[model samples]
Target chain A: MENNNVEILLIEDNKNDAELAIRAFRKANLNNHLIHLKNGVEALEFLFGTGKFDVRDISKKPKVILLDLKMPKLNGLEVLAQIKANEQTKAIPVVVLTSSKEHPDIKRAYALGANSYIVKPVEFDDFSKVVTDLGFYWLLKNQPHV
Target chain B: MDNKEKTIELIIANKKLAFQNQEKEKRAHELVSANKELAFQKKEKDKRAAELLLANKELAYQNEQKDKRAAELVLANEELAYQNEQKDKRAAELILANEELAYQKELKKKRASELSNSNKEVDDLEKRVKERTEDLESFSYSVSHDLRTPLRAINGYAKMLEEDYGTVLDAEGLRFLGEVRSNANKMGVLIDDLLTFSRLGRKGITKSTVDMNMLLETVLSALNQSMTHNAEIKFSNLLLAVADYNLLQHVLTNLLLNAIKYSSKKEKPMIEIKSEQKNGEIIYSISDNGVGFDMQYGNKLFGVFQRLHDDEEFSGNGVGLAIVKRIIDKHDGNVWAVGKEGQGATFYFSLPDNDK
Candidate 1:
């Protein structure tokens, strides 16, 4: 529940896709202290300790943010721009995971300082594998700036 | 001298005086004659003076007439010289006009040749565009074909539900699973159609004499084995076509399959295949007494993913004709169709008779 202890922050609008990603991370034993926010608004609020997360520590940032491109309010790119613009959150690694490889947002995400981009596969097994691999890579393999 | 002589000889003088009177009478007669001669001479001189005056007046009148003639000649000579000058100026203008005409003719020649050169350039550009389009088609073909792997995986996982979770699933859950599987299968078919369509764009034609009779036999038998239909198929004396064997087979398969599919609703479906040689090309036709489409939308028949009939009425992803069109285009051939609603449809394609 505490923001300081969160290692993975997933901002996804689709409940089923979020569940699948969580299951993938759990299967890889990388879901400990994982936080799932339904939209970019909630993700931004949680990151900056505003709104519902007002009492949480603002100094603490997730090890990585898994962003989805298409969302209801405040899309992934906007959230990415905000994250990269802020001095405190700019150093944290952000990965973009979306359904289409041809999505135009992929380039923009990287341009906005996204560390990695992964296309979510249509098949459940491949999707699971990709999510699990990327989770492991970010949480364990990659060295955080903090 | 007579007085002194008279005094001395008075008596002798009487006889001398008679002789002198006689001589004096002779001398008077001679003097009268001379005076008459002188008067005649004076009359002759007066006549000569009057003749001289008349002659002088006539000469003066002739002189005046000559002077008028000389002045008229001088004016005539000056007018001739002015006319000569005008003629010279006209000759100079004529030379300039001829030069201008020659320059215009040369310019026209240059323009005509330039137009022809640009026309040839346009043709070359068109050829290059066709080559580039073929390359792009092949690239997309590979990309779409490679997309099949993930699609297959998706379908496989969706199908795995029946075997793995069949016991725990309710009817609705099973239906949902079926929908997912079917949608994945549909996507797979679409991708395959896209690949086929794109492949036709790049596939080179291998020309060979194909026996239509045998090809139809093989295609019909293969189709029959795959699907059952009470359709009467007919073909006779089919002409040979010089084309790529595999591509020709693909075209026939698509056409025949279309015929069978559309006519399936009829009580007795009839499909006919015919061929003829005309205009240095072999025209092949496939006719079916099926639910034909409206002729208005004929132009869109060969377009990618373009369907005239509803997906519910006919199950097609609409890429079959597009593939046919691409193949025919690659062969430098043409394909067209004629159809009437509820009557029948006939598809025709022509291949160049290079073998002949």
Candidate 2:
């Protein structure tokens, strides 16, 4: 937890799914200072240094943000728009994870500067592999200007 | 002459007497001749005057008759002139009418040509539609085959896990493996249905006079396994129809199976299979006393994999109605359903008179 520059920030409402994603990240050996926010609202508060994460340094933005579209309040698209709109968080990459490939707003998410899109796999093993691959690609492979 | 005169006197007297007598006789004769000549001239003059008078009267009568005839001729000429004018007017009107008829004929000719052009366009469109339909069938077939291969892999591995490594797996892991198997099986069913639908589109239908009553009976007998409940299936006097027998059988089986499946929840499910002839079309209906669907999803009923009821409530892949629709379409017929939620559903299919 020392020098906590969050490398992977996962914003998901479902606790089981969040736990599973974390497990997959660990299995892929790409887990490095990962933070799981319950929903878009918490993720926004964390990024802007408000609400529960007021003491957090806004300059130390996560390298990658994995967003779930269907959450309780403040959906992924709104969170993505807010993040990309701000100059401080604009460079951070956002990947959208959705349940339905036919979700109407997928194209809109890409238009609003989403880095990637992946359909949530129903099977557990496939889900884990997809999550691992995405973590690895964003965290290690792509050299983003911090 | 004196002596002779005296003697002549006596003689003269006698001669005078003779002379007188002669003179008297000559006078008498002259008188008589003059009278005769005057009388003759007077008579001739009178006859000539009478002849002139008669000729003048005859000429006057002839002149009067000619005047009358002249007046009549003028009147007749005037009548003929008026008749000629009327005839000219009629001829002019007739000419205008003929011109109009000719114009109309030309217009009709142009219209006929335009119709012919449009008919050709329609034919071209129909040809394109047929070609596209063929392409779609082949595509669907290829998709089905391709999709099944992956599904088989998924199913095979899951089965292998269960069969080969069942002892090593925990209870929850085994349950998860079962779900995987079931889902794969569902995918297999979906692929099979898609193949059936594609095949139906490609197959050329041969129609013959089919006994519908007998056909329904046969279909019912085939579906003997579906009749768990003592469902009363009543068939009225159904007339014969001209349709593709095999395809029609498929339609009936689908409907009958749906009836049985949906109505299994009813205390006593009553299915009434009836027929009616209207406007040269035979309508066959199957009504089931069952837990039916809402009317809002009516339009989506015949679409592939469009299910109104949840998988927990009714076990179906939702391709049955779509198959029924395709078959009915091939037979040049229509199919529809009317249902209320928690009530019942009546499925109707009509066959056009093959006499046409």
Candidate 3:
């Protein structure tokens, strides 16, 4: 059970939202390599292979990081800044997943090298569509530096 | 007689005659001396009379001068009296003016204090309104996320149920699921609109010179893409305005969309867009030959959640005009509508003319 081959790293605080996003990906048959971290600390800890994830390989980064803006302990923007600032993780595309467009950190997220931004829709169908579409475009269509 | 006396008494009487002659001579001498004295006295009297005459002339001249001096004094006294009267009049006017000035100063002081009090009240009111608007904004914003979170779950689960369990359920069950999804979606829109309405107070407007004609073109194209309608929107040489571009676009889109929807049933639904300059404002009017409302419900047209037509007749969440009103109000503009039952309606919004 190697966790090194993760593709989509979903960093969200709310359990329901995390499950829904996973479900949305699963519905689209794109949840094969997705990993869900409950908080920003865990995501960072998982990404840099530090503390609990020290033994894990840091080189095997996810294809895209789905970062939520509002979370407990080292929120999304800070996590994004750390990811973008590092030499090894800077190439990994980071997508901002926010609850509302009214989240004032929208501009700052982009400024911190977020690859894209998506507002989680209210309707499940639209939400599903958005999740699947991003999966398809980023995983299949978008080419990243190897 | 003296010679006879002198000769007669010759001899012895000669001596007596000589003595008598001597006495007579002495008497003559005394008479001569007295005559001389008389002459001298007469001369002295004549000189005294001349001196008296000169003194009399001097007295007459003095009397004449005194008379002239008395006349001059009378004239001077009259002048002094006139001057005193004038000075008295001036003093009376000065007293009246001083009282008036004091009264004016008191009035000015009172007015200044009143002005400051009202200004303070106005400042307090503005602060409260700002705080309340901010509260409402943050409330709606968070509610959008919080409410939508559960709503998404419900809608998603319902959708997942439909996709996964559609084969096991009846057709009625699928329809109910559809209803649920749509109602959730509508609630989402309503929440979004509420958020936008509250946000108007917090968002600062970035103003620019807007070409009305160009703005209408952009709006028409946008409206065309959003919904398909056959309403002929006409405008030419529309006036320009200095306002927030995006907010004004929002106002136009809502009004035009409403116009098209309200008039959809008409054979030839026509919408005329026009702009005119009036009273330091540029008023743009959108007239639609739609299923207009009774003029009685006109005031309610711009209220939040206020609808003249039922949901079945016109599909709307009743927030378009309210949004329009708020945007216009943020620009210090006015919005109103005039309609008659079943005839037509005219919606007008005016913005301050800052172009020139």
Candidate 4:
């Protein structure tokens, strides 16, 4: 992929959730060069061009990163911090997505430079629509630095 | 004639001289008697002069003794004057010391009464705490026994629907059956959460200072990994707070879940989570840009199975907020929410200082 050419970089851990999100994006017809990473570690490596993702061009940052706040290693907020703190990946819009808004760290994630935040709906239909609409907005409407 | 007369004269002269001598003797005897009388008178005068002299010397001696006595009286008077001044000062000191003793006695009495009153107050407080603990135990028992009976009925009936009628039911019928089962499952979740909440009341809280910032991060990660929400959440100023590490985690998890569920329909939902200090309590709040309800439904928001939104709009048995409220109340805290219809909602909960 060319540098700065990717859109909708999703950093989620659960396979079920990742599949559901991909299906939602396809239904909305907003699927672009969407890349899915299983955890925050992979997400960071992809962005900073390190770890297993060192082969990718460092400059090809995603326009919008949909980040899950929870993952096994280097969870969402830590990933967000690494992204937001670095000048190289600071411009990319990071949208926090989680199941519980009650998670106390939701606020901190935003303070650490999360661009947006969302809670997943338990109902399948609502979840699909939320996913589809959010894909469209962040991927199409949001303009990132080229 | 002269010769004859001379002879006669001589005789006469001699006779006259003899007579004169006789008279002279008589005169001498009288003069001698008078001289003896004068000598007696002179002796009396000399005796009176010696007596007057002796009387004058006695008066002079008495005068000297009076002078000495007067001088001794002046000295005695001066000693008495000095003694009187010393006695006055000693008397004044005694009076002041007596007054001080009285004042000290009054102070000691006051302190004794105050100490007794304070001891009584402490006894009352201890009694009240024991009573409260007993009440919580009974409440937990009620939750365990009384509440579960209804739950068992609902769950049993739903299971019967699927197992017994699976062959006879059509597609839509089966779908409805599925809803019944799921609703029952949801009720089971509600009951479980309620049990957890009530158990918190009876359970002695082992509180330790929690790093809330880290706890929140961990909770958020778990929430995100388990579920998916597309809305962008923005937050700030999440600080470390003191609370029961596990209980607070549960509180945050429930609140955040409610915010996510309620705000599902917004074009672009936004959730904000933060903490603040209020009235000496730690208040954690979650605000969401979602389909909020009217304030009228606010009263029932934290009630068990009390839901404002229809099942079609939001699927919850309304036990989540109740559980949150219970946990907070157990921690000697409070939980409340503020929202307007079609706008956003903010839920606030406060945890009191640790009871340790």
Query: Can you list each candidate's DockQ?
Result: 0.04, 0.01, 0.65, 0.02
Please list the residue runs of candidate 4 whose C-alpha ends up more than 4 Å from where it truly belongs after superposition: A1-146, B1-168, B277-281, B296-300, B303-306, B351-356
Q: Can you tell me which runs of candidate 3 are displaced by over 4 Å?
A: A85-87, A141-146, B1-134, B211-214, B230-241, B277-280, B353-356
The lDDT leader among the candidates is 3
- Ordered list by TM-score, greatest first: 3, 2, 1, 4
The model with the greatest DockQ is 3
Q: lDDT tens string, model 4, A40-129?
A: 888887888888878888876777888887688798889988988899999988889875433457679879988888866544445668
In the predicted model 2, the residue pairs found to clash are B2-B5, B4-B8, B5-B9, B6-B9, B8-B12, B9-B13, B11-B15, B12-B16
Instruction: Report the TM-score of chain B alone for all candidates.
Output: 0.64, 0.69, 0.71, 0.54
Put down candidate 1 lDDT per residue, A1-146, tens digits, no spaces: 66779999999887667877887788788888899999999998999999999988878788889998778779989999999999989998999877554354567888899998987666566677888888888889999897
Give the distance in Å from residue A78's predicted Cα in candidate 1 to where it truly belongs.
Answer: 40
- Give candidate 2 regions above 4 Å deviation: A1-146, B1-116, B198-204, B209-213, B225-239, B276-281, B295-300, B303-306, B329-333, B352-356
lDDT of 4 by residue, B223-326 (tens): 99989987676666675566678888888888788788888777787888888776677778889988887998899999877889888878877777887887
**Selected candidate, larger DockQ, 2 vs 3:** 3
After TM-score superposition, the amount by which residue B225's alpha carbon in candidate 3 deviates from its true location, in angstroms, is: 3.4
Docking quality tier of candidate 4? incorrect
What lDDT score is found at residue B73 in candidate 1? 84
- The residue-level lDDT of candidate 4 at B229 comes to 85
